[model samples]
Target chain A: MNITSAPPTTDRRIDVALPGAAGQTEAVAWLEGAQAQIAGRAVWSEVRLEIGAGEFTAILGPNGSGKTTLLRVLLGELPLAAGRASVLGRDPGAAKGQIGYLPQRRHFDAGIRIRGVDLVRLGLDGARWGLPIRALGRDRVREAIELVCASEYATRPIGRLSGGEQQRLLIAQALVTDPRVLILDEPLDSLDLPNQTAVSALLARICKQQGVTVLLVAHDVNPLLSYLDRVVYFGAGRAAVGTPREVITAGTLSRLYGVRIEVLTTADGRLFVAGLPEAPAHHSGRHEHDEQ
Target chain B: MSSSALPLAGLSLDPVSDFQQLTAFPFMVNALEAGTAVAIMAGVVGWFMVLRRESFAGHTLSLMAFPGATGALLIGLPAAAGYFVFCGASALVIGLGSSGVRRHRGEESALTGVVQALGLACGFVFLSLYQGVLAGYENLLFGDFLGITRGQVLTLAIVAVLALCGFALVGRPLLFASVDETVARARGVPVRGLALAFLLVLGLAVAATAQITGVLLVFALLVAPAATAQQITCRIGASLVLSVILGVAITWAGLALAYFYSEPVGFYITTVAFTIYVIARVTRAVIDHSTLLRRRPEIAEAHA
Candidate 1:
């Protein structure tokens, strides 16, 4: 089987029709042989994927594997070098209003004095000019905070909150817009294991209950493994999308990375992809050293 | 010496008479008008400048007023025109040269420092090149509230109004971009454009404030009130309003005291602003310590 091509047997490929027309299907995002380049170098090319409505998907890769590049392509921040990609049945940038996006986690300086609730409100009308009118969309902000289970400290200064608490508020901020598609970039990076699992479960529930398509980028696959409907693995200028079981096997991953990698299952049935020579041992270190 | 020529109306316990004495002369009235305008503009712009952590840039822009005034004098132009031209041009250079990303903040600070140094150097060069001794040179550095003309007050008022209008236009999106730039961009906020626009507004603010507090003590009106207000409250609206109130109150008090005593208005303004900042900071510390102490026992009990 050609691993580079789209999965032939899966029903996902059948939804690939017009670029900007999601006509009848529930496909929220569609990419056909899409390629993205950064600084004149192709980071990921020949990407073929279709994410349906209410589905929870994770984009996983080692550092410099172009997971973020792919997200930028969808957000319309970066132009696709070749092929076509669409979000919410429109061109990438055109459908931004319906797409809730959480950028990479950032530390709020302790001196930042804005209330957490105010931050959530910004997600609603932050793009609009003029001052924020009080009580406009207040209930929506409160509902979003309640949804994230962050109502306890929503009134406190955002900088004083813990990382997990801040992450929940940011998630609420993203959700306050009532987006049809939620794109979160490395939301679980700085959180502990329990918080990671909790946030992952929260995203999954949002996907199922609110019928919001969830696309999360992550480095580690274990916390999100069970909740993810599909996995889009990026490796050395290539991408593969399938169910976790299909795309994460040694045979598929080895072909994607062009190296002999091993997928091992622990006693608790948690799968670990080992033998990634290019992957950094300490992922956080890689982020810190990355040229901003 | 100048006060000896005018009636020495010292401040009294009665409030109405002190106000009457303060605004008795045309020059004093003009000083108050210009001070009020400058204080209001600085309070509003400085709140955002402090929030965005760009006080260095603001400081550098304030420094530009010196060279701008001197250069304008050398070329036989109005000092106010020089202040705006230099401050605005330097602000554009700093804003355009840096990406305003958090990662490049160190580089931004360096660029700000470079502009500040070059501005000071240009000021001294202009002073040396000019044939005549610069009249009111001390006023250029430490400010002369009594020297503020009615025309200057009008100019300051007009510039302050324009800056406030510009701020009102971009205030919300600017706050969003300042607080969280990456997500704001994704939400379709023009982050880069807002950064540039904010720098320009801040340039206007610095130029106006420098006329009152002078280049050396511009932070007296620009940063001190905003920093004090932010220390006291976390709410954006409350903090901003408090900043403006504190700024206006401080300016009035400073002007009154300078009128009563024989000192530069800048000295009194800086001293009062510093005192308020210290009080606010100490009060905030005390409250924070008490809250932490109160929470400790409960946290221990919960753990137990």
Candidate 2:
């Protein structure tokens, strides 16, 4: 494939009559009552959440909460016992090629020292196995490398790069397929301040510039406050979804944890929710939401 | 004692006679063909074995074939075919019998352990039943490759060809999934199917290696070359290619040295492969230091 950094077609008109277009901007999910249990313990009970198309949504939760489990169900990696769910108007697993996913903190084996652009090429060309020797038509591969700003490191081994560089490489690998929806699990976990800002701005640009919907799962919603379009708080076997401002409020926060939660907003109009039951000890300083 | 009657120990032998002893005899040729074929198959499959961290699976399959080979010998059938059959069966069990890897509670080695135990135990039971029924039990521990037949050689060739095809067919996906499963799956690659297929290919390779190297020496063929190659190369494609080249070179080189030195083939191969891998590791470290010293200016320029 010819990998390039060129912007997408100006027309953005895909005349191939792709599926799920009729349902554009519609809620991808309509769960009346969804539940998941493990060893007779309910992780999620009577929970309902709607994921809209073309929306940059963030799923926020505590460490042991069902945010990840919910994402697994959404990605069709796990099955729900009593629930109806759909992605892109089809079963989540069936809409496989249409979504891009980045797992949390996965370290590639040091044995392989592939370049960043080659990793991106894999997504663009699908997979090549058991076939005659053929490169991905060269040009597409170059184009994909460019699209992700990974061409500079196209020849550098991934292991030699820094952690933030590796994360960027992974993001490029995840997005090279031109997927409709991109899902990242804790993309900001180990990034430095500069990298956190860089990646957040990058994702924001891709969403606004390319119309690619984003779903980010993060435990620390503190970093994502300024850039996210909406927030979905998963807690106590349920979830609360609305605009970040509306959902991170005192009433929503207190109900989510079954304890008093105070949201402090600085003069800059950025909000941070703290005083939850899980971390009462770290309740001294008000968290700054716009620092990164 | 007469010179011929002296113990044939601590002495080098005539290289040509030793070569004849290894191949001119009918049984010796059988071993040569089998050994060569197994070495090639192991080289290719070993690439994936290293990638998947399924070296234990190779060991387990080698052990799992014990009963099948002995049972075949006890019934006066070809043990080579039996080994291949049993290895394939063990692979199938390992791939499909266990629940999904995600269900294994936060333990990476736990699933590997369970699969290893199942295969080892089943192999032990099979060997126990056929104990003392074969000509020599020690030969199984340290293979007597000279006992292999022409039919087995042909069979190994076919197996190697199939494995080569399998590797090439799934080379892209296998590498993709091993390096990054989430990205591969999102891009519509069949991660689970590729994993299962890899296990099966590994089983086949393990079976072939066990027949010549003995179950104990399968590690030498599967791990040593690939591990060595990894130390020397940062490129995935180059690493795999070099691993196979090194594996085949070690096998042939070891065989030649064994003939000249009258050494046991397995021990000779292992020693040579280990030495090469160690040297490669040391050389890579030195090269890294030198590159850093020399390329500082280039790094500064690139950043600018």
Residue-wise C-alpha lDDT for candidate 2, range B1-304, written one tens digit per residue = 1112323332246666555545545755666667677777787788777766777767777776676677677566777777778888878877765442432313534555676677667666666776465664655655555456777788888989988887777888888877677667656678778777888888888888877667667778888888788777756678878888888888776655544454456766788888998899889778865666566777756656
Question: Considering only the true interface residues, what is the Cα RMSD of candidate 1 after superposition?
Answer: 0.9
Indicate the TM-score of model 1. Answer: 0.92
User: How large a fraction of the reference contact set does each model reproduce?
Assistant: 0.83, 0.65
Compare the candidates by DockQ and give the number of the best one. Answer: 1
Q: Write down the lDDT of every candidate, Cα atoms only.
A: 0.86, 0.69
For each candidate, the DockQ is 0.71, 0.40
What RMSD value applies to candidate 2?
8.6
Winner by lDDT: 1
